[model samples]
Target: MTGAVRLEPVDERNLEPLLSVAAAEAEPEDVMPPVDAPAGWSLARRDAFREFHRASFGGLAGPTRTAMYAVVSGGEVVGMVRMTRCDEPGVVETGMWLGRSARGRGLGAAALRELLHAAAAAGMHTVVADTTPDNAGALSVLRRCGAELREENGKIRARMCLDSAIPIR
Candidate 1:
């Protein structure tokens, strides 16, 4: 990570780079819907990956339900972050995944800060996330962003109030 981490709205222009980064840097299971095939980026998995982003990001018509962003670091797409509106008013559920190389360099935390700022600007009152207990990196980032964590049904749920958050610049 050479430059400041930033979130670029997912669209046709940058979507390919984001996908490329994902295919090269992160595991398929970690980033997209799991394919029941082998353990690598197969053609089916690649197509599925593209479709997943396009559908979730709400292609052409723009983000209808989820706001997805290409996580760029050092002027390159390294990962992705997204937030979807929840049933509760003024609340959103966020999820993010970074490439192996981008982890531990504070890019995840920085991208998360940007996501929180965006959520707050979008009038969201609270942000929530979930991860397995074994994912220490996600846990650390969530905690750093002021999320209160609790174990529920074999998963860790994190909740953070935007009112008290101070997003990193």
Candidate 2:
């Protein structure tokens, strides 16, 4: 694929597109009960998901340890990615979604690689991601990015060591 997409830091003007992609990517099955949800999972709660991106991208309220970015293609936003809770010092968690229209084009993996690069650049030593077992697409992306998988708490968690200099490509 051509390198036509660019990942830019999230800002107020691009929050809506990010939210749209998130909502489109999310499925009823993807919704886990809030208590059992993974950390940084406010997006799984009732209606909290709608405005969750705003806290980080709209500058409303959220941990300063988080950084969000929008994946723009042909001048339009088609996906979103985030690296959060870096205050843990060497660790960070990633979350991302490609809009319905952008799926099946290898953009998901590309976006993930970009997010991992961002995390590594920020001095993170490890990056983690989790998805329901049914989400084969997501799991594939994680595996393609060289993440090690483990089954935990009914979810598939993937972790990658960013301290190494392995290129995501």
Candidate 3:
């Protein structure tokens, strides 16, 4: 695992690259089907899926509701971490993905730690994450970050409580 990756906030100019990395890392089985699919629907029907993420991450006030950070190594974006639906004022849910080249490096764990620290500084009480039962890597990262695990509805849910004294930097 390389020890030199850095995390930075996502800005409007970086959304396209972030999406491109996410798409490249996705597998056929990773695509979630629409809850209500029409019969004989084609791939184009998945436009809504892309739009969902686009609207979530793309906008002038991108940091208001959702916060994202890029993991950079050697001056290039190698992965990203995101915190969404942060309106709770005391909790946030986080999601992350690392590009193929960045896998096996400790960057995932580092990024998660940074996110938790940021959340704590923002006066958040809990930081939550979820992963499919099969994703060992993500589970490992969450565990390493002191997340308490729970199983429900076939998913592994994890959470960490923040210590209020830490400063956000």
What's the residue-level lDDT of 164 in candidate 2? 67
Better of 2 and 3 by TM-score: 2
Expressed as tens digits, the lDDT of each residue in 1-169 for candidate 2 is 5435678888768866665655556543342223444454245443465445556653212555667788887787887777787456678888777767777777777788787877777777899888889988898888878899999999999998986655555
TM-score of each: 0.90, 0.75, 0.71
Worst ten in a row by lDDT for model 3: 26-35
Pairs in steric clash, model 3: none
For candidate 2, the TM-score is 0.75
Top candidate when judged by TM-score against the true structure: 1
Pick by lDDT: 1 or 2, better one: 1
> What are the runs in model 1 whose C-alpha is more than 4 Å off?
1-3, 36-39, 59-64, 167-169
lDDT of 1 by residue, 47-163 (tens): 888777878666223555788999998788889999988889899999999888888888888888898988888899999999999999999898877789999999999998988
lDDT per model vs. reference: 0.84, 0.71, 0.68
Question: Among all windows of ten consecutive residues in candidate 1, which has the lowest summed lDDT?
Answer: 56-65
Runs off by more than 4 Å, candidate 3? 1-3, 28-64, 86-88, 164-169
Q: What residue pairs are clashing in model 1?
A: none
Per model, state how many residue pairs clash.
Answer: 0, 0, 0
Q: Score candidate 1 by lDDT.
A: 0.84
